[model samples]
Target: MPRTRIHNMNISLDGYAAGEHVTFDAPIGGAERLFDWFDGRVIHGVDRVDAPVTLDRAVISLWSQGIGVEIMGRRKFGPQTGEWPDDGWRGWWGDEPPFHTPVFVMSHYPHPSIDFPNGTSFHFVDAPPHEVLRLAQEAADGRDVRIGGGPSTVRQFLQADLIDFMHLVIVPITLGRGVSLWEGLAGIEDRFTVETVTSPSGLTHQFWNKNGHD
Candidate 1:
């Protein structure tokens, strides 16, 4: 069955998934170090010539596997707030977005959909989590829907019990003040079967499969 999944979400040791202020200059906010271990090449199936495929790279490579559509928060789309300006800003990613699928961006403001030649299209909507998920699932056809996050988006899906699988990478750093992933999700592990794996790069990868889901 097609499932709702979250992948390659980097969180700090303090449970913060993103920093306090997200600006156009700093996309992930001040928590940039959380993704230091990430290699963008792996997402496109590129391998490093200097070294063999490591465990971390192997896991990160699964980010786009089986994903047909993505749902992300407005913050993940861009650094705009309260009525998008007429600046004609497409998105953080230029013409060719990494996601080669239909992406639904959650936002309160309405905007026309943007399409790219690489099959990446961004649709802006103001619906709740369940409604958005329904739209995404429909666009996904028979494939899985991925929840691309900025923490708040993922939290909403978790709160609605709409996520079937999650892959969280725990970096060993602590951001004392930032957007947390476990804010109101106390005892959320009870709903899933969690497994942990520590990579040689010191990143702990946690896989959460919703209970009763394969």
Candidate 2:
């Protein structure tokens, strides 16, 4: 069976994953409450040799090195601060982003194409969500295609039942108000199955697989 890794490009806590409105200023809501989840790497500049990210460093490293192709929403790609004027704008990650594979961006506004110098190629698609996933999957070849998302995008795909597996590392913080995983998801009781869990930094890494089977 073919599977995709639906994970976050940026992460937060259960509150953000389970919140109401995910915005730039409030990207990860209630994340402060998740210090128990991230393994203690809570965005501090402090560097420790023996210490990992202290913030779900395991999951972060997996995200950085595991996938080949990635799909993201335009809002997640641009400044979570303001509206984008044209297609000429690239992502905020700067010249040499960590992503070097093909990235598919979903957007309504028709903008010109972009080619980054870091071996990363950006493509905009107005096609249906499944179609976009299909294209990205194809581009990924053997490696998994990661679903990089903002809350809204993840919700859309989740509603469509397209996600296969996900690793949620709940950071311990709270935005108080911001975007959530779903507006009407109601519950995921029947959709996902917990595979494994690890605890660190007051944070717990919840690994989930789609229903019925792995």
Candidate 3:
């Protein structure tokens, strides 16, 4: 069976995954400081110019590995809500999205499926996590399905016990307020074999694997 996975999810030292207010102006809230560990050039898709390969770059690069389909909440798809304001708003990524495979956006209000030129497509659906996971798994065609998140979505899947693997990056900053990833997930660590690794950039990487899986 193909596994469901989450990778490179960054959280603040205080456990907030995003900031209090999220708008087009502040897509990730004020938690941009949490990503300072990554080399700016690598994240922005700039070609490397002799920069040493650091832990941050290595970890960020692992995002697309073994992922054939992605599922995300509507918030992660965009900053819009309640009957999308415009159809022209594709997503935060312009022209070409990073995910080349199908991405299912979880929304209460469904819209026509969107197909982009760069092999990235968006399908809007109102199904619950399990149903959406089934659809994503089918689209994945045996490859792993990635739960690309904005805190709330990941929390829902974690609550449903559907995630098979996860890589969480704990940044050394505190947002104080925002959606938290561990809000109601008490004792979630008991279900997985957790391992912690600290990078030279001061970020701590937490790996969680389902108890029975390798």
Select the stronger candidate by TM-score from 1 and 3: 1
Clashing pairs in 3: none
- Please state every model's RMSD to the true fold in angstroms: 1.6, 4.9, 2.3
Model 2: per-residue Cα lDDT at residue 126: 75
Please report how far candidate 2 places residue 214 from its true position, in Å. 4.0
Best-to-worst lDDT order: 1, 3, 2
lDDT of 1 by residue, 83-153 (tens): 98888889888888999999999999988999999999999989999999999999999999999999999
Give candidate 3's error at residue 195 in angstroms: 1.0
How does candidate 3 fare on TM-score? Answer: 0.93
Reference-based lDDT, each prediction: 0.90, 0.64, 0.85
lDDT score for candidate 3 against the true structure: 0.85
- Judged by TM-score, which candidate is best? 1
What TM-score does prediction 1 earn?
A: 0.96
Clashing pairs in 1: none
lDDT of 3 by residue, 53-79 (tens): 676676677777778899999988888
